[model samples]
Target: MNIQKMKELIDKLSQASRAYYDEDKPIMSDKQYDALYDELAALENSTGIIMAGSPTQKVQGSVSEAFEKVRHSEPMLSAQKTKDVNEVVSFAGGREVNVSWKLDGLTLVLIYDGGTLQKALTRGNGEFGEDVTANARMISNIPLTIPYKERVELRGECLISWKAFDEVNTDGEYSAARNLAAGSIRQLDPMVTKSRKLSFIPFKLISPARTTKSEDLKWLASLGFDVVENINAASNLKEVIKQFAPEKYDYPVDGVIIEYNDNQYARSLGTTGHHPNSIIALKWADETYETQLTGIELNPTRTGMVSLKAVFKGVDAGGAILTKATLHNVDYMKNLQLGVGDTITVYRANMVIPAIDDNLTRSDTYELPKTCPCCGEPLEIRLAETAHFLWCTNKECPAKQVRKFSYFVSRPAMNILGLSDKILEKFLSLGLIKDFSDIYELSMHKDQIVSLDGFGEKSYLKLIDAIEKSKDVEFSHFITSMAIPNVGTSSAKTIAAHFSTYEDFRNAAVNDDFDFTELTDFGGTVADNIYNWFADKKNVEEFDKVKSHVNIIYPEKKQTNANFEGKTVVVTGKLVNFTRDGITKELENMGAKVSGSVSKKTSFLIVGADAGSKLKKAEELGIPVISEEAFKNMI
Candidate 1:
């Protein structure tokens, strides 16, 4: 076993785990993670080198500081996972095993004292967890008082039903129910969790144990806990699993958990640090469907970077027809050796996002475009620290301009309402819009605008009114409209505070007098971006042109230290009185840095109605959560 290769695999796997479990941003698919883990395990077996922090040795988990930490009565080990049904059959070894849905949600330990629900904790690093009693009390199905609850530790999956997920995620913000459920359960405020409509389904009874696994579940069910669906795995495991397909159930399930029915016999099998020998998780292989690759679509972004997407004949998998999947980066495409017209297999990753499982054809004949698909500018491959991406050599590619213009008029920037992407593209193609200034001059083409499809006298008037109204913009928002690299809402607010007007900030960058690096979170890379953006002759001209048409209002920043001074605040949900961007800018003016997501580092979270995952994360982290009304009073 190569030690260097092992180290690299370990690091990559660890990072991916953290990305999914901690950050809620998954970088790789389940197949990719399984492959890496299998390789590491094989290496460890051959070399006898179980390196420190190897995921194979320890159950993967991270303890968030948002809740009160509690030590588990006994370590909650992970189940050894397998896709093969034969392995599960072998593990049973003729003894009757109880097979149940391996619910795809956060594993939670619910504690009850005096026949009343007292505490709830997540499986944080197996032995330690944060107390989430308040939220657990609000679970729709969880009984506040159970008959058998005499200081009992009940283990179960906290789940959000597919129906609930679909209803709550009307905006399609969350990709899976399991994630949304986990987020909902970990909330600091029980009310936030209650509204998400989560449920607890018990799988095991830790203290005051029953004779059999089936008996424990039955008892829990009788006590009003929604125990996981189960069946007797009497050597017909495959047939049983087939009957209980994931789609039939409203709750999300990744696989089935099979274990011995007799509690004493199962306990005698012992355990590794990572998993118990008694229980095994039978994961269903991602159901992939074959399709013919038709072509490759090169999607160019506003920054002139191009991304690859496989355009294939649509195939139905898990009820959704899939036509395309991301090729990820140049390295991934190269490994697949994908070519146009090649045979490919695609599947829904986690039964949600479409992903390419494999490429059967090894033609390696795919010809990456040498010119930008939009502008025909000579393309170049740029290698970043992580991956290589194809880039349009010309900065003034029409695709880039269209995307840039679309962004400039977006809510975070100028907050223009009527200019949709299609409208902007049409306007650009017709020479109605040339630059940021041209957006304001759209009124000049009134006769032409009203004549187009999807446009009329009322709509044209609305568009013009929106464009005119966008002129009285916040200075920070106006700065964001410029689309300055590295200068987003937060940085724009910082820069806005440094100077009174757009001209002072513009001239400071143009003349190289003020140091942007001195500002909060403005590193050398950010400062360099400001200088480079101003250095562009075209950008300078566009800035002056747009400046002449709009009124940039620099809000009065609080000079004295405020309650939120140097604090990190996150706003979520639909506010009663303020827009998302409005509240964020308001917080910035009050001397706080506004973040889009919540983490342990966040000082507080300001929420309104229908707050989503960020609000849940804030609760889990034990961060100070304030309502919009409460926030108003504080201000």
Candidate 2:
């Protein structure tokens, strides 16, 4: 082995590892990194010369200047992960083990003393971590006080749910749930952590050890900790794999964890520098289905970015027929050498999202589009930090306005029922609607609308009624419906909560009297977006027109009720006495925040018949549950 080549590999791998584990960006694919790591390990073994900086020889830690560093009492080791089920089965040796989701988020260690939470630390390397106690305290699922009086410690994952992730990720700045969760947790302001709605699910009890893993999890739940859901006891790895379905989970999960039930026996098995021998992670095999790429479709987004979608022959993947997958950006397409008529292998990432795994036939013959498909204007390639994307150069592109209008009437926004994107496209083509205000005036074209292919007398009447009903909208909904750049439902809610009324907010924005940057999680970018949107004459005119036809109801001042004060409640399934919105509003009026998922902070989970994962999670977390009748009686 050449020493110089070995040294170069070490440096390259180290840099990539740091980028992946620390910065939440992978410079190379997992397969590429693993192959290079294997080569480096083999060279070291053959030459009997291990370089000091070799990734195999030591553990690397990330550095963040914002937080104070603290040493961990026990090392937090990574699990040995494998894509092969055979290896997992061989390691298990037919022993009964607990199978649970390997949550794709930041690892956190919590310490409790005298029945009160003491500290929370990130899993920085293994020996030390940055102190994140303040941010941890803001996590909805972290318990400030536990029932156990003795000093105890726990380890878990801090994660964001897909719903909350989507609500705040309007700008598409973060790519994955794990990346968003990591970034949210590392914020200098704890208010950012609170707004992100982070949750902690304990997987391990570090201190006051129990005999079995099941017992430990139960104990953790008893102490008011949200525990990871235990699927079932599996005697073999095959059973574990069969039971591991990531789609059913509310939170994002990268893989499944199979750990020995006997805690003492597993601990005795000992550790490596990187991972312990007791547990192994079973990652989803990249089972790729080959399909021929038919073509690529570029769709203009509300932000003027033309998103590329690959049209491919239909293939079954993860129980779904996938005909199209997002190409992500120009760089991704170029790297894959993707082209029309190429044989591409497609798979479902995490058994949910369809993705292109590889292009077997690197047919680089496909030409990139030089003009915007919608506007007939020349396209511009814009460079982001590490990627390049095609953007529509036309500022007044009709496709952009259509996308924005679609988003404005989306469920999270104004929620104009019975108006589908296809219908909107038709209306746009007919010049019946151009802006959001045109939606209210849609009744004027009722005769024309009813004459359309899908629209009839009944459907047109229903749409008109929905439009009328939507005029009495909440302040947050109105704000979200404006389609301000980078401003989504969550940020709109924050703004509504601060200003209380639409008039107050508008006055402050128009006069430039208030600094939006002072709001929690509202940085300079968000402030600029809000200011610029309000400053635009066209936007102001459109907003004024919409406001004239709508009644923006400000949120009521919450009443301090002993039953629900300062409580976080989650409602699941169908309600009998109250509609979903009604019950949520009632809870909010009583000084409770309604959350979608169950956690330790969830004071009550109102479950109904046909309840789903939230009920199961509430039970696992040992949260108090109530029926609709019981909830009504309490109120």
Candidate 3:
């Protein structure tokens, strides 16, 4: 063995791992990656030398700087993977094993205390992880509180379904469910995660040692978790795989995980440097088929970066026939040596995202378009810190403005009713909406809008009414309408409550020496975003223009609860009279800090139906518990 190829494989795999985990981007197919990995394993065995920082030795992924990193109580290790069903059967060796979908999304370790969800962490390199507690709370399927008390730790995949992916990714922004799910769950703002409709499906119980993995799943499900679907592999790997196959799942699953059913036996088997000995992943490589590339499609994004997509002859992947696959960047396209009419292999990563595996023809004949397809403007090559991407520098590109217009009409923003992305696109194409301010002037094109498909006189009138109604939006809504990065409804409301008016908010960002980071939960990056957005001439002009059209109504804070001022309150359980957001806003308005968990600092705990652990904790801590009606009376 040269060992030179071994070193080279390590480097290549390391790079690919970084791209996939740190960047949330995959540069190669699962099959190709696995083959390289297996080859690396063979080389390592032959040479008896595992290089430092080798992908084989350690669990991959970088801890996000946006989150607080914490060491796990027990290391969340990786698993030994194989594509062969016989290998899985051999691993089983007649002993019962639990087979489940190896979900292709971000893994989270959720910690519960006193029957209430307390914390959640991402599997960052297994030994340590990022704190994603707030974001985890937003997952739709995960219960806030469960029946079983005592401290417990559960491991699960935080995912967005293909259906939810379709709903959220209106502009083809994300190519796959895993990509969107990971991105959404790792968001700094939980509201963003909430909007995406992520679900946490528990695959393993990390705490309170049970009889078997199957027992753990049953217990977790009883505790209100959407447990991962599983079946008993009782000396029958083939039958087990059939139930846990790629085509059988709704969410993304790259493979099936088989773990020993006997907990004590599995524990005795012990773990390797990177994975456990008792568990293995039968990697179901995405269905690959040969196809011919037809052409490349380019889409310009709000950030000015252009996305390159390869259109190929339709081929069946996992069951669905997909023709288009994202090239990611020009570097990827060039690496594949992809050209028009070139014979290429296509497969869907995670059984949903169509991706090119390799170029069979090796034509290397494709040329970068001289101009952006959308704007017909010369494309600029942006030199990023690590990579280069094509940019459409044209500021007035319709593709760029579509995002802004969509944001402007969103419910939390302008509250403009009946305006969808498709309708906005139609408006952009017809030149009815050029800028944010033009949304207010939509009444001018009423006759034209009425004539468009799916538009009747009643619908046009309703739209016009909405546009007129939006002019009377509150200051918070107006601020949210700007679509500044990381500035969602809550942050915007904070800014609005401080500034009191659109003019004051605008001036603070540009004209005055104002520190947005001084606000509650507002970080330095958010402050910088406000400053940088204001610095832009186009942003300033558009903001002011839109501001002129809208009546900036600052909500009057009717503070009836004088004693509640500066108090720390925690609201728990389901309330019929008010939603969580409603109660939180009300508390905040009365100068109280609304904490998520019950603590010694908590001055009051508002109890609702199924108050659960928080109420119990409050009682134990001697914290005051009040009924919803009692809190309402205080309000």
Candidate 4:
């Protein structure tokens, strides 16, 4: 309660906040920080002594004057957090409570007037924020216009989905999704924001707070806002923890937020300089599994980058069996001093992906592979952004070709079902399939294919049928399946939109007349990649052969349909009423743009049984997911 102690607490908390928010690193756990904050607040209250720089007295944020600053109507204080489940139960106090994921992203405030979005700002220093209205408008899920005409202010988290982070991070520049989201929203150019696919999930209504917290979230959803997902009347802390299993959620959630359902009672308790007493954050303790590293596997990707994977003793982590973890690149390997026969500790990052937490024995004996596994070509180290990776310098390495072919038949590319990588490898070994065009000619080897191990008559017939069905592909699908460097599904869609027909695109690429950099995210590198890919005589000839057997359906001219115009949609799992292509065509017909992955811009996720990562990602982003029957009804 003394002024000296208050100053100490203030300095410590401020340092932690700066590291967590600005540096994307944490010096203290959420629990440790919250406990210290609470002690500081209690001391100030009891002794009637508050330091000028106390964390509780003001919002904890650094002001970046790069953008215009806007003062917040009300201070956006941090939430009190705890590691103990007992504290959460005590905080709930037998009252109905809503427990939701504490999304690890940058905080944003949105202002609306006359049912139209007016302004958007970052939670800079709590009292004021940097104006990012232009960038906010570009986010797909942040509704430009809501049903309510009255002036309203909302608080939310601006985040990049894990799926989006991986796609946009083609060069592996960013370390985490939160960091990517932070940097993306702060970009001065709104075009950058659009390219990154940042999304906003509103968690609190700052103005006209007339309804209970639970009711408010429902009303927000009704008004076309993507409200944060939560479970109402969660019985206990254990129940909330069960629901918030890290592996089940697609986005990065550091903890869980538990708040009283009754908004009035929560407000009555008041708040300190740091956090409100009404709500608390429960941070899950990371569970680590110790295992011995047996060996390392170098896996070549489509881009010729060889990723080092740690092969260790199998560990059951959070119900999933994990025996291998990604070493990322050479830099990570050197940092860990990884070696065979070394003891290592592994844990699921966010309870999902297996990650090596620590190497207890820094044996430092693991040697980097000198040659590519598939083609025995000499490997070279390349520096990309901040990381160093092992790459196959040989452009014609069979390993790279195999990965490229595998990607070509992936769901996001050609949607060629039943052609597993093992099957592709077999076909390649037998010289039955040489290039993209050879996939279509697979039917010619039906007798040979059926005679192969694991290839029965029924499976062979099914593979042929799938390949034949894939022949009727769209321009975007065909372009994406080509495995052009730096060109993904989104970029392919953009290219397809600009050049309606395959012939037009090919001609433009050949002549280098079109300005591809003018597209949303396309740059000189992408343009160069496109031109170079087409300029190769072999590629051109192979593409011509592939183009002969398939029908390329050019994109339809933009049609203004009220139902789903300007909407971005993702279809995942299985559908009863529509095939993947059929639903995609239907969505396109209704003016919806179909995306291969789920992102913040995704308006709706059409999900069915056994929905995978996309469905979980949709739930995390609070994007509306419609069932097959519901989709039929809407159409």
Worst 10-residue lDDT window for candidate 2 reads: 25-34
Model 1 lDDT per residue over 1-635, tens place: 38998999999898777655654444565677888998998999999888899999888777788888899899988888888888878877878889898888888898889988888898888889878887787675677776663687789999888877865543233545766788777776564576576777889988778899998876665565557878887767678767777766778887888888999998898999998888999887788899999988887777667767789999989679899787656655776788888898898765655788878986788888889877788999876534456788897788777788877888768999978877887888888888889888888888999999988999999988898898898898988878775466667777887898888888899999988878855666667778999999999999799989988888785753478889978788888988876777677667887765454457888888888766766675578999999888887
Write the residue-wise lDDT of candidate 2 on 133-217 in tens digits. 9889878668889877899988999998888788765435455677789877887767567767788999988889899898999
Residue pairs in clash, model 2: none
- Model 2 vs. true fold: TM: 0.82
Q: Rank the candidates by TM-score, best first.
A: 2, 3, 4, 1
Compared with the true structure, all predictions reach lDDT values of: 0.79, 0.81, 0.81, 0.80
| Candidate closer to the true structure by TM-score (higher is better), 1 or 2 | 2
Candidate 4, after superposition: displacement of residue 333 in Å? 4.7
| lDDT assessment of candidate 1 | 0.79
lDDT of 4: 0.80
Off by over 4 Å in 3: 42-54, 62-69, 112-119, 131-151, 167-175, 183-197, 222-224, 235-237, 245-250, 316-319, 383-387, 406-432, 437-481, 487-635
TM-score of each: 0.56, 0.82, 0.71, 0.69
> Lowest-scoring 10 consecutive residues by lDDT in candidate 4?
23-32
lDDT of 4 by residue, 1-635 (tens): 38788888888888777765754544444444666888998998999887787877676777676899888898878887677888888888888888888887899999999999999999988888889998898787788887789998988899987877876764344546787898788876665677687778888887877558877776676676667888876566577667677666667888889888888899999998778889898877668899999999877765777767789999888678889976655766776788899999887765665778788999999888788887788999986544577888888766666776878787767888998877887898788988899999888898899999998999999999999998888899889878776577778888888887888988988888988888876766677888999889888888888899999888887655675778988899888889998988788878888876665567899898899877876786688999989888877
